[model samples]
Target chain A: MGMKCIGIDVGGTTVKVGLFETDGTLLDKWEVKSRKEEDGKYILPDVAASIREKLAGLGLDLKKDIVGAGLGVPGPVMPDGSVEVCVNLGWHHVNPQKELSGLLDGIPVKSGNDANVAALGEMWQGGGKGYSDIIMITLGTGVGGGVILDQKILSGRHGLGGEIGHIHVRDDEWEHCNCGGVGCLEQIASATGIAREARRKMAADSRDSMLRKFGDDVTAKDVLDAAKAGDELADEVFEVVARYLGLALGQAALIVDPEIFVIGGGVSRAGQFLVDRVFKYYDYFTPISKFKAKIGLATLGNDAGIYGAARLIL
Target chain B: MGMKCIGIDVGGTTVKVGLFETDGTLLDKWEVKSRKEEDGKYILPDVAASIREKLAGLGLDLKKDIVGAGLGVPGPVMPDGSVEVCVNLGWHHVNPQKELSGLLDGIPVKSGNDANVAALGEMWQGGGKGYSDIIMITLGTGVGGGVILDQKILSGRHGLGGEIGHIHVRDDEWEHCNCGGVGCLEQIASATGIAREARRKMAADSRDSMLRKFGDDVTAKDVLDAAKAGDELADEVFEVVARYLGLALGQAALIVDPEIFVIGGGVSRAGQFLVDRVFKYYDYFTPISKFKAKIGLATLGNDAGIYGAARLIL
Candidate 1:
């Protein structure tokens, strides 16, 4: 007697789709190539067609098999179900909820920001399982995060809440951030930022290192692997990047003080070593001893966004 | 029939007490000399006797007239109602809620940190009135603040959730903050910090100013008053202090993104001038153009703690 729900996580390159039981059991999962044609006009329709085909293939009917659906958009989502702006999806001046709801024949679609959706997913069944208050940071191409307090996401009035990546962690920064800000935490904590720091360090120090030959092709993974291999230069690069990340996190701890911090994104594949390094600086920067937020790696990985989206409506 | 409740704001020097109706109407208010002798052994007992005498004078029965009592202590309060430490009250490892509950003859008592309680009070009837999500900064002898999201205080796991003063905004600070941190927001935003900055300016620049004559007797009020008089030196000092304070606040906006920021305490008395100055820098620091958090002066002032404490039980 269980019903199914569709979860959609909209990304820059593709859309992740998951069919799940109301009890959070994943029945099936697939992907849809995100066609940015006509300013994302066909995206929602494509999603609806995918769900309808899936339902027909499984011999399930709407209203009987699926009650509702949720979406995690690659942009800031207002509490009123409107998308402020989505640079990646060409989503501008759009209300995804109302638009998608009409397309789905009033299936009661709910939407949230992708990062916030991922956080809700983590809280629901990922690394933040059994935890209500949490902050999850994704350190892939960029540093993005979501905050959950009192069992609900803090989306803020203008959809700017949980924008932890943009907090100014350095005062001496000379370069401009993508957000037009100076010295944003994202500049030093993102995977791209790690590689940039490593490149700068190698250029300045003239040290013997495994990354000496890679030059501009060096990735954040290379830095982590070299550090793991005990390359002194790579380890030093790791420590500097980790220090800034920890300071930003430690400052956040002083602000919201969540129960646990769930680290995710492609860069988090470095695993326990990254968590341990971030926590070491986090502990030193945080003043109080009794207050400690447990650090854990994301268990859901790519599925976190979709699960969080489904949970948004569920 | 309006039932009365006693709201207590426990500070280091004096305890501000208020008699309020259950619906939040204040009937009367008074202050008591805080006798911190012998590790504050007599403090609670003294408060209890004072309340009993007041009730007797009014011919009110405890069980019939008073429904609840709340205290806002000047320290972190655990969920179980214990204060970890209170430097001013000489309290260490004391259960203020339990001790006060017993002293008041089993009357229901609830407590919270003074700043957290103050935030609740502001949310209830002050600058944050009708707004549940808010951040209130009290720039008194030290910089203290409280954060409320989704209509509840985030006291945190270690009772350190709302310690906004401790966010490290500067990396080059030479002197240590009272909390042992370097270059904390409190070191530049508090009244003492402002005066300290003003003193440093006076010592460094040979600018002829009214503050230079006052020597170490200069206060934050003096600097603000001088700036109001169009003192060039005072304006420069105000600019620097306001810059740091604004940067710290801008960093916070990126993190919590609350609906409003209530500025209170001694320094806030500098009034609209200070608020405008902060907003000027806040706007420059926040990345998003659509994002905005309304700034307002705290209306409750010193009585905010008592009202907030009373709110705990109400």
Candidate 2:
């Protein structure tokens, strides 16, 4: 049999594991409950056990068949493979690469930030498949980003290389962002930010629209849905979202000059519609004749982390 | 003698040439008038002749003593060592790298944008001397920039990686920038921008200050000098420059996260005082706890381009 690799995406709630061929073909995928007990000391052992059980079931030998493993963790990862801190996993100064390698019987292991790996996965097989340089923006609970230069993740000096969510966009914002800054891109472009903006817009003036029907329980999805349904008020809200997103992206292009921008996350479910809106603003902000970064939606969905993790080992 | 390299900085009116040892010791430097006649066909030949004459005078052979050559042009350069266009030099689709190599008995040659090369030069032996990742901001006739990540110039997909001047910063700007963008960082943070803002501030109100003596003939230096001498109006003008420049640098940090930002060009002559002012706003915009990019002034001045170009060959 050809050599295989393991991909692990360690989230706050669960540990996603995937067995894949070196050619990126997934053979098996499963999830294990994350045990946060005792500073999450059992997490790597649990993952190792799960992989061993799966290999045994498939009659695979670790020494002969498995090549290595790669991991995607939810925190800043230093060049030395030690994580600075992960509030979700209760991890601090943990070297997952060394621990996982030791756990898997000295198999070679590598790791990167979850968002950065996901971007690598997308570049390897998703929206940024054909492009080498890319920036992936995830508008989930908070605005997250990953910068891929020359097909490698730019993890930066403090592992803050792709932290685009914190780019300040507004000057007059009164409220502070979760990062303690006011008017960050995350404060206006994230799913939470979109919902908050919807609520604020609704409160500012009584507009007759479908978003009003949701009352104070409006979500980003509802606002997107309402916009698609031709509601003027919700469309206005999305316009605001697109403006900040596009502006931030434009500014990012001035620095990295990626060939394409692949946008992912739950908010990307709006598809090409959101991509188009953001591109308009991106074009407006970057007036250089050579401004030619194409915007597209990510295709890997939830499995991007696993795919990216596997790519890391390869 | 040890192997030596040649660094060429091509400008509109003059071409600066430097001969250096592989270790970056500048042995000799000179300049030649740029001959724009005949579509700049004489530019390369003239540079090649100058280098040969200098080598002959030193009794050095091209094949035995010279390692390679590098060129820094005032335009975008593609990955294939070709320039898209240099309007200042009337160049279109020119491959200086290939042509120069042929001219120098087929020695290896490399080329990059002038601003990007300057950044590399600063990173190698100037203000960013000890840093591996840096962004060099040149606030001159225009706000030019070069991004150096991992000690190499990031000349982006279209060679616009460090084009920070075009980043849109204000939504209320009515005047169009040279690049056709409105409210670009260049329009607010550049030398011309500082002078323009100073004039506008002086005209907006009859405030008794040192700038009143210059009236309509005020220059960026006049404003900076007055500010340094405790002129409130001039100080206010510099505050605006600092605000825009700091905001742009903070946003740049979110993308590439360089270890240091080296401020260059004529305006940087204000030195540490200006650096301190810009840092204040850069700090306010980037509130991440791990945000730690230091700001400093470039030390090499004009020689940065030649040093950076030679480093390119090394």
Candidate 3:
């Protein structure tokens, strides 16, 4: 490879590592089991050591082979390269770039917020390939967004840019968001939001075809399956979710006006089921931005993080 | 001057023009009467001739002294510099930039949305000085916004970026907006919106001392004066307006997250009476962004458009 870099993705479950070329082509990929710790102070060193061992196993000398290392951790990374807070990982104000650089024997390291890294991944080699301005939204348990404006990841002054999940959609009715706001777009549109809404609608003595079959524990997937089978309640669930999401995206479109909105994560696996409904409601909400933009699904899957990280080296 | 440009502010009432140096220093300034017609084809040629005459009077050749001309029209400008649907100016699909350029003997002209240009003006020299990322809102009869991200003007794809006025504020129970949407930020928080709400409240029951004083005609300014005099109803109007405006700004902050929000236009002249009430309610709407950014009044007065247009030279 002309230029090589180490790409590391730290999640709550596992740590993914990849050896990638400057052009975002992955040479080899592997995952190491995360050493879960209640306290994050002890977790950073374990991650650093695991990456070093992986590089050694690949016969790649950290100091000679890699130009630098890029890490995407779950949470906000300060502009100065410190992980300010990771509620899930229980880390605060940890300088992962410095610690990782030291562990790798003075090799350079760069880090970003996880969603931002994912967006970069898409921009580099995934769904957002060849597009300079794109907005990536991951609809997992929570809705997270990453903004790439003019081909650069836009991290607001407080590292809070791309917080599309927190932007309000409803007026006075919505569940409290993880970020402590009510009526946030994420509260009614994410996977958790979709499941909660389905449960709420089903509990109101409302007659449903498929929901009545599945007793209490319902998931977003259940709604999708039922909708695919042409259940009224399941279709209604998707309509509600898409309506809120379309309104939020329309509002976001007024600000950034990205050429494309790439949807990712588990709920996005619903694919055209979710996208078609979103498009219908999108026209209803997107009066001003109708002629300006388009919406699409993210193409990259699990490896977007590594590809995006490697892209930073170029 | 290393680089100089002409800034022309075309409005329904008057035309303000200034020759500005690259450092945002005003070299010369003048104002001319405005002509509003159904199809005002003469406005551009007149403007261009006036500019040439003004430059000649100062012993400055238009071609040699000015690198380019920046025009700030009171509507959306096409990417090709043609204007579309200026409700205030009563023009539709007018190519003011091309017309002005033709009159200027083929000199290059750059144009932008009026609000966006106003923000560029502020960012270049006024209240938003030294800030690369800023959002400027003109709280006039309507609510208009200009967004600057990473030192470049964000006009979306079709020149509709800073349309902060059209974002949804309420789910229902507000006047319909011009965009055929219910509960737009403009429908509840603009001067026109405030006046309409005040009229409805006054019509409900005659308990307000301020309403009796104003009789049948109640404007946003009338409400402001009554609030200043401690009229309960007038104060209520201000409270409602401030509450909604703060909420809208907070929602906008979550998306753009600009370093500063500059408020201008006629209604914003209410000063602390407006800012204090807006800040009070802003916290309720924005929990995540409130800690990071601030909302302030626009420092540039009626000349904001001219200054904004002039700042393009800088």
Candidate 4:
């Protein structure tokens, strides 16, 4: 049998697992419910047991056929593979790499931040397929990002590399982000932020638009759908999002100067329409004629995390 | 004899050269006038002649005793060590690395941006000595920067990595930066920028300031000196500078998250006074309690470039 590696993406609700040929071809994939009780004590054990069962059913020897395992966690990870805290999974000081490796008959393991891993996945086989240096911006409920430099993750000294969402974008934001900072890019560019901006815009004016039909419960998807259908108010809200997102990406370009910026997550469902608008502002802010970083949409969808996780071990 | 390397810092007016041991000790240093009369055609050849003379004087063989040469140029250098344009030196499409290596009897040669090499020099033997990752901000005639990740220069795809000075920082500025961008950090934080801001502030109001004595001849040094002596107007000017500089550094921290930021150049002569003020704002912008990047002054002054250049070959 060909050498194999296991990719594990541990989220609050579920753990996505994938078995891949060492060369990155996905051979199988599955998921198991995450158990957060008793401080996530059962989560790792469950994942290990599931992997072992899968290996047995596939008639593969763990020590002989399996190369190693790669994990994606939802919090900052020290270079030593230990997590200080993962609030989503109620984990504290967990060494997933060591623990999972131990539970898997002494196989090796590597781990990284979830957002970072997703970016690696995209670079390996998605939007950033041909690029070695990229910044992946995930515009989900909260904005997340990852920086890949020369085909390696820029994990940073504090494990805070690619935390682009928290970069201050506006000085006028009155509210705080989940990270407790004011005027963060996440405040105006994430899915929640887009909906919030839409609500605020609708509340601030008597402008007639389709977003008004949803009132306070207006969703990001609804606003984006309306904007695509030529809703002026929705279009205006996206312009605001595009401005902040573009400005932040431009700033990132100045610092890291990645070859391309891969836009992923829920808001990215708007696709090239959103990308073009953001690129306009990114270009304006950067304006370096020969050094502009390309902007593109991520293509791996939910499976990017698994792909990136596997890439860590490979 | 021990293996040796030559470090050359090519500038607009002069070239600073240093002979170094392979382990980075500065054995001897000298300078040569840069001849820019012919598109800087003689600059590298002149530097090569000077190095060979020094090596002969010291009784060292060119190919047997000298390891290589490293060059720090005044413009963006491609990964291949070729420059598209270096206006200060009147150079275009100059491959300094190949040219210097050829002139120096085929010893290896590496080249990098001047600011980047200075940062590497600082990291090798200056303020960032112990840190493998750093962002060096040079606050001179123009704000300049270099990013070192894992002890190597992050020379971006477009050679724009660590070009933090051009990062957009403000929106209210009416004047365009030298780079043709509006509200760049260099507009408020460089030595020239500080003097300009002081002049604008003095003109805006009859503010009682020691800086008023300088009239139209006010300098960044005058402003900093006055601030050191408790001039309120000067203090306000620095507050603005600190705010923008800190904000830019914070933005950089979010992307590369280096272990420390090394502040260098003319304006950095204010020393820890300027560093403390900028750190205050950097901390405010990047309020991540556990992941703060330290700020410090660059210790190596003019010789940092040569030291870093030699480090390239080593």
Q: B1-314, model 1: which lDDT tens digit per residue?
A: 67888888888888888888887888788788889999987888888888888889888888788888889998888878888789889999999988988998898999889999999899987889999889999999999999987777878877878788988888888999988778888888899999999989998999799889889888999999999899999989899878877887787787788899999999999999999998888877786555789888999988898888777787
Of the candidates numbered 1 and 2, which has the greater lDDT value? 2
TM-score of each: 0.96, 0.97, 0.93, 0.98
* Candidate with the larger TM-score of 2 and 4: 4
The fnat of each candidate, in order, is 0.60, 0.88, 0.49, 0.80
Top model by DockQ, which number?
Answer: 2
Q: Report the Cα lDDT for residue A279, model 2.
A: 92
Clashing pairs in 1: none
Candidate 3 is graded, for docking, as medium
RMSD of each: 1.8, 1.5, 2.5, 1.2
| A44-158: candidate 1 lDDT, tens digit per residue | 8888888888889999887777778889998888889898679988888899888888887788899888898899899988999999889999998999999887667888877
Query: Which predicted model would earn the best lDDT?
Result: 4
The runs of at least 3 residues in candidate 2 whose Cα sits more than 4 Å from the true structure, single-residue gaps closed, are none
DockQ of each: 0.70, 0.83, 0.59, 0.82
**Candidate 2 on A19-128: residue-level lDDT in tens?**
99998888999998989888888899999999999999999988799889989999888888998788888887899999999998999999999999999989998999
Model 3 spans > 4 angstroms off: A36-38, B1-3, B33-38, B78-99, B105-107
Give every collision pair in model 4: none
Give Cα-based local distance difference scores for all models: 0.87, 0.91, 0.78, 0.92
The DockQ-based order of candidates, best leading, equals 2, 4, 1, 3
- Candidate 3 at residue A287, lDDT? 71
